[model samples]
Target: MREPAKSKAARTIEVINRLAKAYPEAQCELNFANPLELLIATILSARCTDRQVNVVTARLFKKYRSPDDYAQSDPSDLELDLKSLGLYRNKAKSIQSCCRRLIELHGGQVPRTAAELMQLGGVGRKTANVVLGNAFNINDGIAVDTHVARLAGRLGLSAHKLPEKIEADLKKLVPQEKWTLFSHWLIWHGRRRCYARHPDCLHCEVNDLCPSAFRFD
Candidate 1:
C-alpha cells in the first residue's frame, strides 16, 4: 500500500536525520575550487567517476583557466587533454560549446540559474541543479543522480523511475533549507551502505525505517 503523505513526510525527516548522522561529512565529492571550474568538471563527469574527473581536472583546470581559454583552444588539443574520460570527444565538444555559450551569453561566468545553465551543451536539469546547489549555494532543486535515484526508490520515498519525477517527489518531502545537503546524505549512504547489488541492510542505520530493507537478501 502507498504510504500516507503525512506519515511519509515524517519518515522522510527521520531518514534525513539518520543519514545526516551516518554521513556527517558528506558533500559533493567532485573536486573544484570555483563555479567555473565546477562547471567544467561537472561537464566532464558525465558517465565518469568523480575520482577520475578530479584526476583529469587537476591538470585540465590548470591549462584552461577561463571560458575563453577553452573556447579559444584547438578542438583536437582539448579532446586530447580529456581523452582519459569516457566520452572524451563528445565531452570536449560540449565543453567548448558550453564555454562559448558562457562567454557569449553569461559573460564567461557560470549562470546561477538552472534554466540558463541547462541551455548549455552537455547540461541538463541534473547538471544544472548540481551547479546551482553546490557552486552557487542556490537550492533551486535537488540533483537526482543515479545514487540518489536508487536510494529514493529503495527507501520508499518515491516510486517514480524518471529523475525529474523522483526529484519532484523528494522536494515535497525534504525541507527547502537542506535541499543540497539532502542529496549529499543520500549519495553518501548509497555509496557506503545501500549499494546497488548488495546493500548492507544488517548494519544500515536506517534499515528499520526502510520498507525495502533486507528484501534483496
Candidate 2:
C-alpha cells in the first residue's frame, strides 16, 4: 500500500486532528488568573519550569498586584523572591523594566498583541506568544518553547536550528485556527512522550504520527 502523498499542510492537519483528540485538556500549565500574572509567569518561566514558577508566584503575586506595583518594586526583594529559579538578577531587572514599560505605554495593562508585548524589555517571541495565547486569547503565533521545538523536530513538522525559524515553518503548514491548540498539544505530547532526555515513543498517543515512534516487528 502506498502511503498518502499529501502535502505538508495535509500532514499538519492530520497531526493536529489526531493529537487534538488525544490531548483535549491541553493548555498552559502556568498558574495565572489575569494578564499581568501570565506576563510575569512567562518571564519567570525563562529557563524555568511551570511548577517552579508557580511556587514562587504563589507569594510573588500577592506582593505585586499591578504593573505599577512591579515597576516600583525593589530589585533586592524581587531577587529574593525569584532566587530559587536562578538568574534572578536579570529576571528581576527585566520584570521591573517590563512593568515600567507597561505602565508608561500600555496604561498598566498587559498588551494583547504580540508586537505590543514585544515592546517590553523581557518579552521575546516565545513570551509574546504565551501572553497573546493565554492572557489575551489571541492565536497570533505558535509558542515555540523547548518542548515545542524538540517535539516539532521529532514529529518531522519543522526542521530548523532556531525556535523562530521552526515557528515560521510550523505556522506555514498549520492552519491559524489550530496554531494555539497545536502548541498546547505539542507541549502535552512533549511532557508525556518526547521528553528532553529520553522519548518513550512506545507509550505515545500519537506514536504513529511521530517519526520517533518505536516500530518493533
Error of 2 at 202 (Å): 0.6
Clashing residue pairs for model 2: none
How would you encode candidate 2's per-residue C-alpha lDDT over 113-206 as one tens digit per residue?
8888999989999999998888877889999999999888887888797999999999898888778878999998878867888778777777
Query: TM-score, each model?
Result: 0.95, 0.94
lDDT of each: 0.92, 0.87
Candidate 1 lDDT score relative to the true structure? 0.92
Residue pairs whose backbone atoms clash in candidate 1: none
Worst 10 residues of 2 by lDDT: 208-217
Prediction RMSDs, each to the true structure:
2.4, 1.9
lDDT per residue (tens digit) for residues 1-217 in model 1:
9765558899999999999988999999999999998888888888878989999999998999999999999999999999999799999999999999998999987888988999998899889999999998999999999999999999999999999999999999999989999999998998889998999999999988999999997
RMSD of 1: 2.4
